[model samples]
Target: MLKTAILVSAMGAGLMVATVASAADAALGQKTFETTCVACHGAKGVSVVPIYPNLAGQKEQYLVEQLKAFHDGTRVNPIMQPMAAALSDADIANVAAYLSSLKPE
Candidate 1:
């Protein structure tokens, strides 16, 4: 009983942290998307190009990892490489939150 309660509490705390982080970064993400990402990714994460994957409905952690890779030049998208390299960790996280929340088309 005690263990279960502790586990539940920990999970709840983690969710709270994630929500707070997402909320704080959501606005910044919208701005970044308008300037940098929308050209390829499209508004609300729906991509017009078949080669460009839809980011909506992707796991948040997966999105974050991919963004980090792009920023570090580990992932090679011709147009994205330089832009990703310029993004801060907060930008990546916030953008992930905003995009991931969109419904996949």
Candidate 2:
């Protein structure tokens, strides 16, 4: 039916909008990383410190989940917990997208 078709089209449009917003936020994420994460994770997502895990080439979903866990105390890490605590959901998504898009060395 035309009504069903319209609903599907609206859903697809909504997805497209979300995709565009996420892409825009990825740029914001890079800035945030430079300001906050580069000290540990490096500019390319490779950590200069062996103790810090390299974030390059990670799955976006996994990164999002881990960040959420770190924020919520489901995963315990002194550093990450505090770091993630400062981030909003959008920030988490943005950073995860940016990190996951990188190629590992």
Candidate 3:
């Protein structure tokens, strides 16, 4: 019973840490977007060019899947394939979360 209590406490602490880390990831994503994505996607995930699709308010899961697809060559885009290749799974998730959190016009 003592061991069970200890395990439960440890699990709760781990969950808290995970939540904090996930929050940090969104911040990182925001920074990444400002530096890398703003050139095309604009500061708020709206595209400046008609050719580029706006990213704001999209579903997080949809962005994640599309990014993963670009990274994996399942989706073909000369620009995105190379860009997404540089992103890790965590970066992809973070960026998706940040973009999806924005309001669309």
Question: Which candidate do you rate higher for TM-score, 1 or 2?
Answer: 2
Candidate 2 lDDT tens digits, 1-105: 999999999999999966754663678778777777889998789998899999988988789889999999999999999999998888888888888889987
Model 1, residue 94: what's the lDDT? Answer: 80
The list of candidate 3 runs beyond 4 A from truth reads 1-24
Global CA lDDT computed for model 1: 0.81
RMSD of each: 4.0, 3.7, 5.0
Candidate models: Cα lDDT each = 0.81, 0.86, 0.86
Q: What would the per-residue lDDT of candidate 1 be over residues 26-92, giving only the tens digit for each residue? A: 6777788778888788778888988877887677778888988988988988877888898888888
**True-vs-predicted CA distance for residue 14, candidate 1, Å:** 8.6
The candidate 3 region of ten consecutive residues with least summed lDDT is: 17-26
Clashing pairs in 2: none
Which scores greater on lDDT, model 1 or model 3? 3
In candidate 3 the C-alpha lDDT for residue 103 amounts to 95
Per-candidate total of colliding backbone pairs? 0, 0, 0
Q: Higher TM-score: candidate 2 or 3?
A: 2
Candidates ranked by TM-score, best first?
2, 3, 1
After superposition, the stretches of candidate 1 with alpha carbons farther than 4 Å from their true spots are: 1-24
Q: What is the total number of backbone clashes in candidate 3?
A: 0
